[model samples]
Target: MYSVARPCEVRWVNLSQVVGLSTLRSFLRMESHMSRCFAAILLVTTLVAVEVPAVPALPDAQVYAVGVIPDLRGMLQHTSQALGAAGKTLPPGMLEMGLGGMLGDPGLTKLGNGPILVAAGPGLLVPSWGAILPYADAEAVIAAVSGAGLLAEAAPGGVAIGSAPDGPGLAKRMLPALDAVRAGMPADSDLRVVVGLDRLSQAYLPMAIAAMQGAASAPGLPAEAAGQRKLMLGMVAMLRTFAAQAGALRCDLTVSASGWKIDAVQALRPGVLADAIRPQAPSTDRPAERLGAGDGPAVVQMHGCMPPRIYEAMATLLQETRRDPAAAALIDESMVAMVRDCAGALTGSFAMRQGFAGSPMRQLGVAMVRDQAKAKALLDGARNLFSMGVLADLMRGMGVEMVFEPAVRHAAGLPVDRISYRIDPAKLPPGQDAAMQAAMMPTQEMALAPTMWVWGSPSAEIDAALAGPRGAPRLAAEALGAGWDLYADLDMALQMKMQFALMAKQIPMFAGAFAEVPCGHPMRMAAALGEGRYRLVIEVPVEQVADFRNGFAGMQRGRHQPAEEPETPAAPVF
Candidate 1:
């Protein structure tokens, strides 16, 4: 009778005990599931706020910064542990990836139930996000992630924001992978990660490495022992001679107010050009068959990289050397020795292409790039920017290859047929869109700019857009013409490649064919030659777009440096 009289007190004691045990369980469960932030707050809260119930976060638009997501299990594990420790409730359908069938070691069970918005790990800065980049660090990154999560809490009003960070160049590839995550996740998701200022060095070391691989080349060995020995000895000698040039160097990564950025998460396929370019004519080292345009346009962070003209010159040199025996002879033993030395330099150094020769098959790849002109131009230009040794250093700061060709090919398609591309090497970067009223010339009508090419976009939509009031022709009036350089929507280079390869079947022509290169389509050709030639610079398919605008603020400010801006949003609809 005494115990029954104290029913309310007994109930309170049981509830408190249950709450304590549950928290303990949550802590224990999520302990090893992450890089593990210190749960100091949770501990303090648990100790001091015993009677206070946890309040759910308000529903609001959210952005997510997804990172290093491997398996669904890991995802669940992270979510479970975080929520459990926080003692917060999870939104509905949060655990559906199926833990039973998922790999071993489930993460944490939900601490409670509540609504949440999801974002992925990787992300790119928006138009002006780069301004605050330097301020971001681990704590800042965590806040961005949390702030993004807040944005994701709202329903039916979300979209992912990112470009591929995981394409091509492996070591630093972030964009292609970011693109993949951006694509792979639900359309409503926004995956992002902006680490702290403290982490800037660690984050960008990989950035440099990814960029270097595409700009440099390695030596070729003649497969025979004699050939290998020749390359090795010459390489050793070269290293001894140039040893004085080797020293510690550091690069200051300036946070450009000019919006200087690169999504290096993907760089050029490392040494793919060195080992696979010209595989057909073993001795001539020219193409026997057109290597199927090896892959699609690899998303790369082209930081401090050369304009397309440099590559064009190198390609020409390589092609000339391949077809002409005299030119081949011109590449004397010394040059050959130099090539071997460059190849050798890869060893004990950061040149990613060095060890590739060790493979039996790779050794046979004496000439990865068949066009001697191209090779020479690239090598020559590379020589001036810095010696081979200095180049090795420069290469280190380049970028990473995120997603390889297969990954890019499998990712998605975007419709871009109706675009009027303006390849202005000297064009300026556009002024801030936000300040349009103030920035615009009072009399001139501002134009609509081009949108980014994403997975699932097609050119037909642009073509269809032309039939409307703001058609291609009207748009072209602004995006095209004399002063402006453009690749008139036709894929001429691709056609020429197809035409020559089918009719002549000549290896030289096949190798020279434009379609054989990555991003070979005329529509997306790299920077154009100053003037003239058959490069993909054309007027638009659209005839009239009063709203067409230029996106070149670089040109506006008279900044001569070429800038490649990715993930730009669609301009105002014409």
Candidate 2:
């Protein structure tokens, strides 16, 4: 018999001394069974004790996005209800299958309602990305997705999946960053995306600069090519400087049954670019409010200040172009000076409006002036250059000649110059002269005052602009009241109808799809810019949402229709 060892004692025995051959075989089988049972128990206990691991930090990563779903089941139910309300529904059993089933893992339906992390890194070219997904049972998930050809590994409370060779490793490395992002996520945010702008600039700016420099300095290039290369190099250099002072850009999105909203901010380091973008005190007199409330099919209005850095960059680029003899011959020093002076005289704050009135489109542009005398001088210089036939000479090779006629008119007690242009029919293609003239703008008018400069197409539109705001304002006024820097509203249905009518012959599908679109509400957009951040909100009303769904369904059905050829192409009425 073999002696068993006590806690503090040791003992050894030969196999023959321990047991007989037949008895030993029976004992070996029993021992093997017991070992397997112990391993099974250990695995169960370990899995029970496993807690979700902290997301790994990826400091070198360039982009990171996380989508937090507090209750995936509830979100899915809400989405289904919303679709039903809009007269749409998903295929039967789609929700039960879950996203995993769509991805070739039907058994991976039991996912944890936690934040999903996706990240891409340091390398710009051939950048690698990884995703981490929380799971109710990591082992079960791994087994379910085993045949999906995805690189997946079990984490503490989730599964890490990656793009190519060793994707799981990348996913593991990204967990810490995900944890950090979660800590800072907004309470109501369903999604957050972070872009490491500075890191990107640091990694790729030098390479871009070097490449542009080489191109600019290359020998035997044409004069125009050399000038263009130099201009591009200058612009890239400016962008590098601007990016160096730029930090990460973060955007958070909040979704609800009503609509979705996104807030984005970019951190700006202390630099000239930051100063240029710094928001100024609110202005009492917004030019956009002066835009006429036209009874047109569509209208667009925008008001914003041009950054000083943009003007400086433009001047620098123009100077760079002048260094090349061929480019200088085309854009003389006087022309450059005139452009620079005109740009400098403007106070940066400007407003623009465009209205689509049935056939012809009308637009008005207004710019606040710092010095009216300087602006007038610049305008006079431009007219002199035009009279010298500089523009005509430039367009001569293109089978076109510009004929300019200037007439002075009065609007709101200011002198408005009514200018019209007629093409020289002799220079036009033989049979296309009348069609070309029909497409040209009939007239353009401009008015310069002490405080502002206004210009637009057609005399009537100009008069409306001169006559300040009418009775009540539309959605754009509400945006202004909320302190949005810029606002735009467009009648999507009207635009779609116009586009379809214009292209019905070439694209027969559009005509059929247009019939399905109900008269929908306008789409509205509002944007605000501050010292270092920008926020934009685009909203389509619930009514318009339904319209879009029906329109999309119609388009799908019309996609298989054959095209019809027309003898005469539809001409645009202006």
Candidate 3:
């Protein structure tokens, strides 16, 4: 068996395998059992040894941060022991048929797990994680084992997992990067992320600029290309200045069921664009009450800010980007138009839910739009470019006719889930009855008119469908479980691979040399600030956290391909 020079290491004989394989064989053959007595006579016993290491705790942050402490050695040892014990009891002919070879060299399994430690700050201002594998130390042991021919019988080539050249030098290079992440970080910060930002702006940014400049200066370029190039150059300049001002950054976030908000603070010095879009006092507006016919819409209604705060912030940013008088004038005109026509003070959603209770009958009411007159005026004025009289007449027709009540209860014996669809008329100012008739005409299953009385119980045809498919409920439960698992696996794989790919591009050699990459489990929630480190706290939904033991067992079973049964021994040649 291969052995490393760990003086204080303890070796554990898998007791179950020893009894099931070795003792079972001994009991079957008297001579073999006697041979073991000779082996015991020749053997020399030594003192037992034990090695243990301390486990580190995670950092304390004000908000929320996930901590990861991976014990690579322990994991490898446990996995190897399990595999070794399971491999010992193969049938007589199976070992000769390369089944033993497929199990791998249990004797040569002397590798230790490389542990990783990660500490994060609240909301991911700066977080650092690092691992150092003792690869250089393993080379010495490998050389010794080969010279002594220890593993020649066990595994001719020996197990060469994660064998890399210049292991010490590569590790030396990486350790500095780990240290650098913490060096300049604020001691006050619970977590810190130190990036090679000078390289990003001063090096990569210039390279991009040069490439773009070459493209712009190329011959036979279109006339408008020059203007586009100039604009791009201006944008790049703004970015460079922005990067310079943002020397180091920190972020914090607040998350709730409603949504999430991120507040990022950057250490800044003055930049041209920064001055242009300096922060202003937040606006004060009484939260506008839901404005419309008071709960009169039949189906669904929603009211909120017409232009959200994010849109306003974007407009401000766009205005700052205008660097010339003509550009400023164009933006001003656009803003004026937006405020006058598009940017309504309040917006609402209204849908009239009208159907026969227990019948496939439905009627869509008018939009129940507030400020309908103002909307009519805007379109009416625009008709001069085309024709105003027709639109004005149609608007008048819409205002006069339809009225929906706030709430209408359905009759009993209806399915809980119901479908509703809108009726679109080809011609404007069509009568309500005409519109409703057109909507139901395609189906020809229900007879309904666009009248006040629409909601009712399900019709006989629909009632039969609701009562069908007894197995549907059970099938749905199974589907939901399977769907959740499939989606969770796919989501986890995709997200991790994407992040790894990004990391690999920057550090090719170190990342590309990995033997087997580990994909961590999915996170329920995560938040990020503009082009910065993703702040994630592990909040796995209870339903999604597969039981640790069961999941591991399932994975093991999944990976193992089933082999044919061993042939029975011949019946002593009859």
Predicted model with the maximum TM-score: 2
TM-score of each: 0.18, 0.67, 0.27
Residue-level error in angstroms, candidate 1, position 48: 60
Per residue, candidate 3 scores C-alpha lDDT tens digits across 12-76 of 53332222222222322321111111111100011221111111111222211221123433333
Q: Distance (Å) between predicted and true CA of 153, model 3?
A: 33
Cα-based RMSD of the predictions, in order?
29.9, 24.1, 27.1
Steric clash pairs (candidate 2): 55-175, 55-176, 56-175, 56-176, 56-177, 57-176, 57-177
Give the Cα lDDT of each candidate.
Answer: 0.22, 0.53, 0.27
Higher-scoring candidate on TM-score, 1 or 3: 3
**Highest lDDT against the true fold, candidate:** 2
Lowest lDDT sum, 10 consecutive residues, model 1, at 348-357
lDDT of 3 at 47: 26
Q: For residues 113-216, could you state the per-residue lDDT of candidate 1 as single tens digits?
A: 21122222223432111101111122423234334332111112111222232211121223233343333232221122222211222334345434432222
Q: Rank the candidates by TM-score, best first.
A: 2, 3, 1
